[model samples]
Target: MHRAERPVLEVADIFRVHGPAWRQTVQLSLGQLKVMSAIEQCRSAALGGHVLRCSGCSRTEIAYNSCRNRHCPKCQASAAHRWLEARQADLLPGEYYHVVFTLPAVISAIAWYNKAVLYGLLFDIAADTLRTIAADPRHLGAQIGATLVLHTWGSALTHHPHVHGIVSGGGLTSDGERWVACRPGFFLPVRVLSRPFRRRFLEELAALHRRGQLRFFGEYAALADPAVFARWLAPLRVCEWVVYAKRPFAGPEAVLAYLSRYTHRVAISNQRLVALDERGVTFRWKDYRAKGRTRYKTMTLGADEFMRRFLLHVLPSGFHRIRHYGLLANPVRRHNLAKIRGLLHATATGAQAAAANAPPGNLPPRFICRHCGAPMVIIDILQRSAPIRAPPAQRAAA
Candidate 1:
């Protein structure tokens, strides 16, 4: 007898069956456990959903609900699209820069343990570094704005923390009266950005350590010693930290398109996932150090190991990975946006400004049926895996 071909696999498939076993071997943090549960249930019938009936063809389909967890691989695209649409108004009619700040190996080790404390510091310090360097008279001497997104995993699912920042190539002058543009082809010097970035991050990290705010576990427990931590950070102080700024973007549209790719990204998208079976979980990963075909490689880890690596990226609860800074800071973004537009005399993007200012629920529905090209009405709603009911004891008592 011949066997039929196997069905294509999904991350959910792998996680659902193997995740529990992996959890048995390790004591996962509440955040990690929650992330695992979300990824496993994402887009499945277990969660509530709605029925969409196409009026044109009289075709009806059941759409499963999204888990909406930031780490869910299946849900980030929609989030990114909505954000890009909103960003239509945030665009400044000038060159924008793609800058990335990476943590060094020594500090990255600490970040692996004390993720919340160190990662938060990284975001703040990186933003402050950009603003401080930009404000110097020797540079643009203007207050810049940035959209910062933190990415905590490497291509192979390792814990490599970094921030990808989208920065305006120009900004408002100190008096907020005029826009100050950088040189046509360049933003601030990477060297200038790197020094302050390294200084500020290290300073804040040390302070956190001194206050015992940082955690060290397993092999890193010795780092809790201030002297040992100081020695570990010493090499980083003099060595050049990685702060790279690409050439200025062609225009604002290109900036938005570029940012949409990075802003809502999770560890690995579904497209990159290849197969999972008795052999293990195999996926494609890019080796940035290599050239051409050699750069692309497939890695297969045992099911348990794969889950462990995936869980490494589970963020602490309520941590905001994407943030606005300086002139783009949430509180002053609108007023400052108006000021910059006034100085530049650029045309408004669309009704985006109005749409953004409108109350959340006041906006119309964003979802529409693809088949009929019409608005989808919720004909029915599904519930979660658990049915809505009291236990037998409660029913008996009543």
Candidate 2:
């Protein structure tokens, strides 16, 4: 059984109440609650699905259906596969890089109030920054393709909003006659990208304020004043917004692996929930900046506090976390991908063509019965609360 399937009253059980409470209170965010609930219900009868039985012994078992929501940590494997399959044809014969653009604490606070608007602004600004920088004569001088995903929480479930980007390391020149590749290991100057991102984001934010599209409340009420809002944004002018570019991925396969791991992750995984008691919840987290490979650290917080942290990540309803830009943009993606594939084929020779046509890695094997060590077959489907009849006992002799 998965960690989440264990008994209900264990220390880990704190997450159930804590996660939901936080979301309901709006102290924690909605995204966290949906993800937590999905994790708890995964492979369980609440979803009402069939289970596998032993073909030889006729041993029965129960299987639960999945929520299949995109953000569900337990449900993204198949979803990612489907997405990657569609994106396969868009691959160009070139390297890819990962870029992250992080909003400052000041902006993050504002974003906590105006989530959908500001989050959408972040995507547009960052994407525009990359496209504009790449198209500049001094840069790659081409139209780049990028995939952007929004991540709203830090490892500890703190409300730190950021955007993760997967970008082609090169792009087609404006004329489309030839491809313009970036430096083998470098995509763009972080400083340049950061500056443009801040500018575009602030410009749009100002426009929104002017149009009376932003709402301020509680401690943020001061932002409703134009002068105060402008003053509040002043510090960001000199502050360096973080723009990180990691080394190029090993290949397309590596990129997919990264996405599978990071894309669907929730506020906290079941494995991370160590114990729950009167002392609150104990959980593990990674301190990314620490050296000596001292990766895992444990934290304990009050149940209410834990819930508060977890719910701070819920996204607005109907908001999309993943987005495409440039050549991958929906309007012209089909045409762009076809053209790129043709270019790749023209460049690939005999051996490369053969390798490209090779089948991908096989799927992981399905769950099997431990008693007989054989593949289990499904014989019946059951929904929750479905009744079953028990056999009558034999009559006693006089």
Candidate 3:
């Protein structure tokens, strides 16, 4: 006989249990609290839902609606799927490179206090670094396109701010009449990319400081002084900044697959939660320093600490986490892509052709029956349940 599978543990479960007690103990921003509330109520009656019946088997079930909060781990999968579907038409028939620009620990600490300004600089500078370097005569010397995604958390849910860029292998010539491609398997040198990225970022950061745009709090409050801030930045100038470029993707499909993993990732996933109990919240994390099988490890953090780390990555409201630059910039993207295809003598791929032939506004149905493999039709609309005014009392004594 087959053994029954255990149900998965989710972040929402932890929030529902411990959040009230934790909230009384520490301060949280409006945005962070909103994220917590959204996670706690996601896909539950709190958000309302619909009743579905299978066309084939007559099976019926109540399907609660997702919170649709971008930061919610449970909500990003469908968001990523929809995003990838839209991006399919933009795929070019060439190599694509994955480049990452990571901020050092010192900067990350400051970023925690001044998120909007600092994180915005990170995105703008990283994209500029790629476009500027790629435009050089010694480098590719072409105007390329890129899609950059900002991920603020490490595997252990630590605040590790970085931008992952998916860049096309080639670009249009100066006159916009020809196509230029990079050498196979190689993009730009990381060492070359790193120095400018560091310099440009620091310069812009200093400018922000001079303009009094950056903020500070707690132990970092001394950074409000220009002299103290200058001294703090001194060490970072000499330290090496990290700019990493992975090998070119095998094909467009591989690029999309890789993007699916990175683009919509949250601080933690539901699958990684191994246990939650008196000891704390236990989860699996990857140690990049370890080799082979040893790299994977499980870690436990006290419920309060775990919630602190999770909330550390809550972004400012209305910040765009994913961005485009150069030829892929939204305004000129379509025109530039048409020009590049013509120069390369390239025809639309089968996927692109199908996308074009598809009827306008024709979207696939979302819900389906698991048992009967048929479309799930909505039979009843369920109004949202009243919001929980307070998280339940702590379950520590249980």
Candidate 4:
């Protein structure tokens, strides 16, 4: 007999059961606490939502509204789609590179505590590295455009911080006269990027340190002393700061597929969650260190530990995870794009084509009846179903 399909598991299932206890034991930032609360209530009757009816069968169902919080697992796919469509016009005519810049483990230790300052500096320095290397006469020497998305978690939900950049493979000449494409398969030399990136980042870090802008805490408190901090950074200069550029994407479609996935990815998705019971939470994660079959393994962590790993990724409030730079920077993208388009229009082959992105102001029905496979429409409204209340034990722990 065919095996029965396992019921879908969500982050909320674990959060609802253990969030209060976890919160009481561990001191959490307001942003992390808010994220936990939102995830727990997302799509639950506790948050008011509407009743929906299938148009064909008239089968009614209560569809609770989503919290629409960025970190919530259920909310990002639509958000990524809409964001991709809205920025579709930003696509350059040629191939794009998926470049990734990762912070070393030592820096990540500092980054965990000084998130806003360090993360922002990471973006700025990464962007500067790309633009600088690309603009050198020996290299591409043209002003390229890039869309950078910040990701803070590794597959195992560890605090491995990195930036994913979707960059145009080519760029415009200084005078805005023509497009300059890089060597066919390669975007930029990885070794070249690594050295400069490390140098620039360290300089920025030292500057931040010198200016008394960086804060150290707990065990890292010794880094508050400039001498100790400088000593801490000395080894980083010689180490290989990972700056890798993947092969160029085939075309615009590949770029869109990539953006759709990475731009809004949370630390973990619901689909990866296998079960949450007395044993603990079991989730599928890729062990990048292992080979083939050994790579895909399920890890079971205690509720407290799982929640701790999840909270490690909660970003500082109001920090923009997705950013644009170079020709794609907000201030001058329109004019710069027009210039690029003009250069494309002067094409010798007349092959380059233009496309406009038209995003719908209102979204169509997303939910469908499992029984009927027909679209479900909202038929009625409902109020909050239950208030999230902490237990006496949890309150005492708090």
Q: Name the candidate that leads on TM-score.
A: 3
Worst 10 residues of 3 by lDDT: 1-10
Q: Candidates' TM-scores?
A: 0.91, 0.82, 0.95, 0.90
TM-score of 2: 0.82
lDDT per model vs. reference = 0.82, 0.75, 0.89, 0.84
lDDT tens digits by residue: candidate 2, 203-285:
89999999999998889998999999999888888888899999999987788778876666666665677778789888888
Select the stronger candidate by TM-score from 3 and 4: 3
RMSD of each: 5.6, 8.8, 4.4, 4.4
Report residue 17 deviation for candidate 3 (angstroms): 0.4
lDDT of 2 at 59: 76
Runs in model 1 deviating more than 4 A are 1-7, 351-354, 357-367, 387-398
RMSD of 4: 4.4
Model 1: colliding residue pairs: none
TM for candidate 1 is 0.91
lDDT of 1 by residue, 1-398 (tens): 11122237667788888876666677777677777777777767877787876655666777777788888877787788778877877887878898999999778887988888889988999999999989998999999999899999999999899999999988888898889998998998999999989988888888888898988888889888989889887888899999999888888778877877888888887777788889899999999999999999999999898888888888888899999999999999988988888888876766567756767777555445665566656687888784322122224554
